[model samples]
Structure formats: C-alpha cells, structure tokens
Target: MNRWLARLLDTRVPALPLALFRIGFSVVMIIEIEQMYRFRRLLFDPMPYVIESTIPSGPLLLIWLAAVLFLLAGYRTRLAAVVHYVMAVIVLGFGALPHGEDWQGDSLILTLSLLLLFMPSDRVLSVERLMERRRRAREKVKDPGPVDVRLIHTVFLYLTIGLMYLDSAFFKLSSPMYLSGLGVWAPSTLPINAYHNVSWLMSQEWLVRPLGYALLAFESLFLFLYPVRRLRLPLLAVGALFHLGVMFVFPIPVISLLVLALYLGLVPAGAYERFTRLWRARAVSLTVYYDRLCPLCRQTVAVLDALDLRGAVAWKPLQDHAAEEPQLAAIPEEELLHDIYAVDRQGRIHKGVDTYAAVLRTSGWLAPLGWLLGVWPVHPVAQRIYGAVAEKRAREGGCRDGVCSLARPGAPAAEPAPHRGPGRLARPAAGVLLTAWLLSFVLIVPAGPLLRTYVTGDGALANRLENTAEYYKSRVYPWTGWTSHGVFMDEHFVNYRVQTMLVFEREGREPLRLPTIRPDGYTGSYNSGRLWELWTFETVKPELPLDQVERNMSRFVTYWAVRNGIPLEEGRILILQRPMDVTLDRFRRDRLADNLSQPWKEVGAITGSPGQLKVSFTGEPGNQSGLYGPRS
Candidate 1:
C-alpha cells in the first residue's frame, strides 16, 4: 500500500497534459471573453451577471483577458495566477454575482484557474518551454525539461472534481426532486438548458429518475474512489459519462467541457506512451476529412494539426476530396456535408467527435483521452454532443460565406510559432513559485473553514479570503463587489424572468412591458444591462432594504419614462416575477416559450404618487425574489 501510494504521488509525468490543458483553458477563456464582449461585456449575458464598475467593464475585462493570454503562453506564470485569483475573488464576493440562486456558471473556471497556479502547467508545448529549448540549443546544452514536484499536482486536480461532485451532491440531496430521483430529468427539462431536441426524454421518468439516482451515486462515489488506484480509470470513465450527460442536456457547457478536458489528466503518466508502444499507432496514418467550407471546421483542423506531434493526421477538405476519394462518394452528401469524418490506414472510419477522438489518440499525451472518450457509454454520449454542435455548424468563415484565404500546406506543421512574450520568468523562478503555491494550497484548500467557505459560499475563511483578495485588485477602481464568478448555474433548474411594466393613470397610454433596449418611440432607456441585472440588485442587494424594493422599482420606471419621452407624472410601476418550470415541456420556439404575462406574480410594486413614488416588495418562504419578509 505504501509503495502504491508513493507511486501514485510521485509518478513522473510528461509536460504535455498540463500544456494541452493550459492551451484548452486559454482558448475557452478567449471564447468566453469574446462572447461576453459581444453581449455588451457583462460577465454572463442578457441578465443576472456581475460587472458594473466605476471603470467600464470592457476595459477591465480586457485587462483580465490579458492575464489569461499570459497564462496561455505560460509566461510570468505566478503573476498571471495572482491577477486571475484576485479578480475572481472580488467578483465572487462583492459583485453580487450570486444573486441568491446558487452561483454563477463560470465560478468553476475561476476556481480551476486559481488551483492551476501551483501545477507545472507551463513546462511543455508552451512559449516558455520553447524559449528554453531555443536557448539551450544555442548554448549547446541538453534540455532537461520540467521537474516533477514532491506532491502530485494531478491528484490535487482529481480531488477538485471530487469536491465539485460532493458539493453538487449535497445540494441535490437537499432538494426533494433530486432525493426522489427526478432531479436528473428536471435540469434537462429546463427551458434554459438549451438541449431542446433531447428534451423529449423528460417523459421517460423511468430513464430520468434512475439516471438522477445514478448521477447522485456517481458524484458521491468518486469521493471514496479517490484513493483506490485500481478503480481510477473506471472512476474517471464514469465521471466522463456523468459530465458528458450534463454537457449534452444542459447549458452549462463551460463547466461540463472544462471537467471533460481535465478528465484527461486523470490518466496515469506514460499510459499513452505505453499504449502507443503497445500499438504501433506511430506507423498508423490518418486522413481527416473536413468541410473546409465551414470556418469552425477549418479552424478545428488547424488546431488538430498543431497538436498532432506524430505527423499522423492528414487533413483533407471534403470539397477537394469529393472526386478523388471513393469513400466520400459512398456516403450520403447530406450526412457528409455536415459531419466531419476520419479514415485510418486500416480503412476503419470514424465520424464526428469519434474522428476527433482518433486524432487525439495519435496526438502525443492525449492518446488516453481518445481512449476514454471512445470507450463505450462515454463515446456514444460524446457523439451525441458532437452531433448537437454539428447541427448548428456555421458555414461562414472569417471572410464570410467561406470566401476567404485558407491556404493549407501539404506537409505536417513543424514547431508552431510560439505565441510569444507573456512573461519572462526562468524555469527556476517559475518552479519556486509553483512549489511555494502548491505547498500553501495543499494546506489551505482542505482546511475545514476553507472547504466550508468554498462549498457554502460563506464562512470565516471565505470572509478572510474575500478581504485578503480585495487588496490585490486595481486600487484605482474599487472591485469590492463589482466583479465575481458566482456559482455555476445556481438557477435551480428553473427560469426566472423579471418584467417591469408601466401602467399610466392617463388616458390612451396603456401599460407597456419594458423592452430590454430602447423602444421605437422612446427617448429614455432603462437598460444599461440585462433585465436580471436590474432584478438582481432589486431582489438581492443587501444594502437595499426590503421596504425600498418599491422605491427601486419607482426609480427604474421613472428613468425608463424619462428616457422614452413618456409623459408619466403618476404611473404605477409593477415589477413582475415570471417563474417558469425549467423542467416542464413548454413547446415554444422562444426560450421564454412565447408565454409572457401568464404565470406572473407581482413581487414588488411601485405606487406613483402625484409628486413621488413609494416602492415595496414582498416575498414568500418558497420564493427567491431575493426579498424575504420578516420571518413568521
């Protein structure tokens, strides 16, 4: 047992896993940043996100992303980590990002980014490594590569997955729906889940309830399985399934995909090397067929080629191969047009995510990742996910309608251009920083109070961490509560849409539901952010007393009237809370199901007097209006 423990803790790992994970994390960060920016740069979107600082959120976010880019290139690793952690803590604490549901979705990413600092993430396939290599080559010295640490960073990463599951399981257990084994179907049924096609399965209570129980057990089981070496692969494999299921049927792709990516880390060091040595996949050649017409497809191909260290994957555009490849003609054009496929030297064919899985199989350090995904239940689910994404494939490119320069070289790519110069710390300095962090984190993360704060979002350690982290933010702009990553999808598998409408006492000017942006004839606008943003503050802001909800409503309505040029000396503003069953089958094209004004409750009211308005809000025990009346 001691020998096994030693092996488990001290196994020498290649730099590839960390590098690949870093690159993937960076890409996700950039995508998330771009998506948020496109949506007016609020942390989340269209609602209930956190970010309204004295400093405009856009510049602040750009600065945050610069740190991410630095992290991506593995430069100034310590500084980037500190910067990210500080921002994350500020957002989590003061930004009111939580808004009283559970937590925001990106919180997982923020937490992982914090833990990432302690790992040897920059040692391989990074700009830092590349610089060291070049420097070594110039000086006629052997490149020794990265050093393995005393504690297993990979194990710590594994435990985080367990922690996430444990916390989620705790919440699930607390919910009657989950305890009754209906929770699995409930989240999938939510209109907000975005997995519309498969939502039909909600009726299969047999399938869903059991799946719910299975998920609960699955999540809870891994905690015990952490120390069992023999079951590690199976544990990770099962985890892949649980997360893949969530990925397919939920809108929480950021966390689901992040977890899936990290699952690759659970494979023991040299597992892929052993697999490759056992099977001469090095001798294997792969021809990847992609719809070059799709920009996403082309970009995916470029990334795959860049990561394929074995010179094994051959990229062919389906448009170019239609005539030459007999296999292309054999498949239906409709099927071939949308989904990407791969043909191996053995004449075996793989499609969609399976094709990508095969490419990863040949790609150094990621072969086991391919193996895990290609394994039975997980593979099937992955295919479904791939199909789902494929269903929404955009044919457009950088130049629009695939009419752009995508020059492809005939040979395998060599030593990709290092996305250089994020930071310039030498290996020794970086290692020292990493070691110090790991030592501290190993002690801190598992401490009773720290764990409590992390899981519950409030505790002594949480308060201290929150306060200490504030010191790290840019002093010029106070981030006390302006930036945060709330818990991931604390929406409780329910959709809450808050609507405010003005009812004028005057003639012919009927009440109008507040449009998110400027209305056609309106000179005044109330929406600087999403509806949930306004609602989040009104319903949950602690400083705003319960009696002031009506006043808050009055403020918003008054502002809206002024902006829209509506003559409103005395118009009542009603803050309506529309709570919909996320798990119910509301068959409508709009995410709101085109059902508005129905099933609405007046959570808060603003009475417009001749001179000024008085605002008030009420909440019942079961409701989450963020306003709780005096306890009975």
Candidate 2:
C-alpha cells in the first residue's frame, strides 16, 4: 500500500498533456472573452443593477483580457491564473446575477481556473520555460534534462473531471427523460438549443434513441474507462467526436470547446509523445542553411530552432556545412552567403522569404503562419520586406572576415532545458486538497439524498446534515444542478416559439414590426438564439413577477432601440407566441411548414416610452397580474 501511494504521489510524468490543456483552455477563453466583448453593451451595460463597484465593466474586461493573454503565453502564469480567476468570478459569476446571465459553462470555467492554481502547467511549451533556458545558458548552467510535473497534479486534474461527469451521470440515470430516450430529442426540438433546423432529424426515433443511450453510457462510464491506461486514448477520441457533434448541433460553442479542452488533460504521457513522434516522422523534411558568422542570421535561426519542436528542419550553417552538403555545393557560395536557403527532401531549393516560409511550415502550430506568408498578395509583400532586411545586412558587411560575437546557431544557449518541478510541499498539499475535493463529490455533493435515505430519525445530527447538504446544493453547487439534471428535462417541451417584436405606433403608418428580433435565415437564427432566450425566458416570461418583468422589458426595449437605431418615443414592445407544434407525426407527414405559417398570439406587451413602459399580459385569464400576484 505504501509503495502504491508513493508511486501515485511522487512519480514524475511528462508535462506535455497539461501544457496542451493549458493552451487549449486559453484559446477557448480568448474566444469566449472576444464574444462577450463584442456584445458587452447588451451583456454588461444594460443590466438593471451595477455590475462592479471599483472597476467598470469595460476596463474590467480589458484587464481580464490582458491576464488571459499572459496566461496563454505562460508568462507569470501563477499570477495570471489568480487574476483571471478573480476577474471571471467578478464579471461572469456575480455580475451576471442581476441580469440572470449566469451560465453553467461559467461555473466550469471557474472550476478549471481554480484547478489551474494547483497545476504546474507552465513547465513545458511556455514562454517562461524558454526564458529560463536562455537564463541558464547566459549563466553557463548545465541542462537538467526533459521537463516533467508531479503525477499527483495530473491525477488531481483527471479525478476532478471524472467526478464531474460521474456526478452528472448519477443524476441523469435517475431522470425519466433520459431513461425514456427523449433526452437528446427534446433539446434538439427547442429553438433555444438547436443551431440549425434539426426537428426533422430529431423526429427519427431510430437515430435519436440510440444517440441518447450512447450519451448516457459515455457520461456514466467515462470516469471508469478514462483511468484504464489502455482505454484512455480511445475514450478521449470518443469524447472529441461527442463534443464536435454537440458544437455543430447546438449554439453552445463556448461550453463545447471548453469540455473538449479538458479532454487534453486525459491524454497519457507516453501516448502524447508517441503521437508527436509519428507526426514528425510523417512530416515533410527540409534543410535550412544560414550564415553562421552573421549575428542577425544566427539570431533568426535560434528563434526558428526553438519553434521547431519536432526537429523537422536541419539547421546547417552555410559557413561550416556548405562544403560537406552536396545540395549546398550546387548553389553559388556568394548567393548562399547573401540569402538564406532551404533544400527540401526533393532537392528543390527555395531562397530568401520562401526559405523562411518553408522553415515555418515545418514547425508545428506555425504552419498556418507559413501558409499565410507564402500565399498570393502576402508572398509578394513578404519578399519585399525580406529583400530590404537582407540588403541592409549585406551593406553592413555581415561578420567581416568570418568574425562574429554571437553564439553558434545550435549552441547550448539555444537548446531547451528542463524546468524545476513543484516544491516539496506542493505534492502533499495537492494530495490533501484533491482528496477533500473527491470526498466532496462522493460525500458532500450527494449528502442530501444519502442522509434522507439512511437518517430517517429527524434528530439534531440529521437536521445539521440536511442543512449542510441544502447549503451546498443551493449555494456551492447551484450551477452544477443544470448538468446533473438532464438538460431540457422540463415537464413539458415548448410548443410555441417566443418572438419579440418592436412595434412603431406612428400616426400615418401601420404598426411597423422592426427586424431587430426577427431572425433572417439559418445564420441569423443561430446567432440571435441567445437574444431570444434573454428576452423570452428571462425577461418577459409570464412566470416572472410583473414588476420584475416590467423593469427588464424597459431595459430591453431601451437597449434594443439604441442598438438598432429605432425610435421608441411612440412605440410599444410586443412579446408574441407563435405556435410551433413540431411533432414526430407532423415530421413524417412533411407538414412541419404548417407550424411555421401559424399566426402569432400576443402573450404580453410593454406600451409607452422607454423609461415609462407599462407591461401587461394578455395571454391566459390569470396571467394578466402574473402567476405570483393576485389578479387586478
């Protein structure tokens, strides 16, 4: 047992998987932030209450963006992680409360950021690692070999993710909707979830039923299969496919990509290394020849060598290896000295800008940049830029008489060195924290159900446990309930589409419905799905209190008018419910078009100007005064 514990706790593992996870996580976050920034006025500014006290939303977003960028670059990573986490909590967590903008994906992001605090994710493939390598070289320190992180950190990450899926699966299994195989089909039918018109596909019982069961199985068994060494890679591949499908089918791109990013942490060290090795073996080979005696040439080569992680480029100094290489011997010595050259495996020579582009193409993650530089319009501009730089270097007499002060191209200074692993206390601390976290998953998270089953006496102990469980469920794990309860497991699926219309009550003209909320086509439907949800579900729903809905509608109308340049002085906002009975029978009969052509029913309306808007419900008899209030 002691040996097993030691192996689990102290063993060193490759940090590549964690590094990849960090990069992927950062990329998804960058995209999410950009999206939020694009819609900041709608998302942050129009909230009924103040979002932040000290920092305004705009500046806060900018600061959060800078922190995320630093985290992405892996510079001052620990500090960046902390700053980003605090900013996320402030902006996304609490700030969303007033506007009912809290998303379950934000919870996952918060959890991941917390996990990042404990991870040594910057140990490899980071700017910090590169800087440390340079520092060691400058100080003449010996290389400490390949970078590796503690096995405990990797275990912590995997267990946290596993428990999340397992927790979700536990609740899903209990849900009648999932057991009846209506889990996937129900959500696909809703306009709020589906990106495209997938009602026809959802109507196919043969396809959806199996997909529903498969999703349940994947979520339920992922925790078990992911830990098995041999099954890890295949499980991750399956997960990738699952998330990719979700991305195409739904508008929840942020959540889908975030979940996919987490899968990177599950990749085994050996498997990742093997995959990279295979990629490098199959990649096109190229040899780059540069002037070693020239300071500028050597500097440029050093940077490229660092980026060439797969060693696809053979960097040979023309001053030293030209005589030995037949390919170099074919080219004029004067031409070789004047400009950089790349000889591919086919023995075709590329010069100047093309040579740089060729080198970039061989480097992993830099291939897109290489393609951009070599493409039409860009290639010509790049050639001119390269020529100007090359001309200046030649005029200055690069390395006069074979004398240069810079280190050689492939010197010890340029080679990567292993970074320091986590501190001695880090392992024990992480182990304790992770153990407690897993215990919360098993004990605290489901405490309510467990206590209710076993402790039926209703004593003091039972009461305390019940209170604690309720607190955890309501406060600590509020966002998690959405994941646990099968998504779209509502008692009744929506049979009507909620449409918000901006009506202008002009004297000479009929009530004009502005195109603000009306989606144009499939793309518009996909983009404005969130807007519909905000106005329909959160703002103007009949279930909401009349006063609250009125306030929300006022803000909504004001923002809508300002954003779309619509005059709201003599206008009223209408919340119409359009019948959309997308049943399996209708789908089979090819009568889905009948549902779309149905006339709109005005369920609610907000009349008068922006600030003085009065909300009134015209739906069912009792809905006029709202469900929570007495009828007037």
Top-lDDT candidate index: 2
Per-candidate TM equals 0.52, 0.79
Superposed model 2: Cα runs more than 4 Å off:
1-5, 46-55, 100-102, 132-146, 269-285, 290-299, 309-311, 317-320, 327-358, 361-422, 447-466, 473-486, 491-537, 579-598, 619-622, 625-632
Give the per-residue lDDT digits (tens) of candidate 1, residues 487-586.
2233433433333334334545666665432232111123322233444444333334545444344544554565466655545566554444443322
lDDT of each: 0.55, 0.65
Model 2, 194-311: lDDT tens digits are: 5666656766778877888888898889888877888888888887897787778766677778888888876887887777777674654998888765657665665577678778
lDDT of 1 at 69: 88
Model 2: clashing residue pairs? none
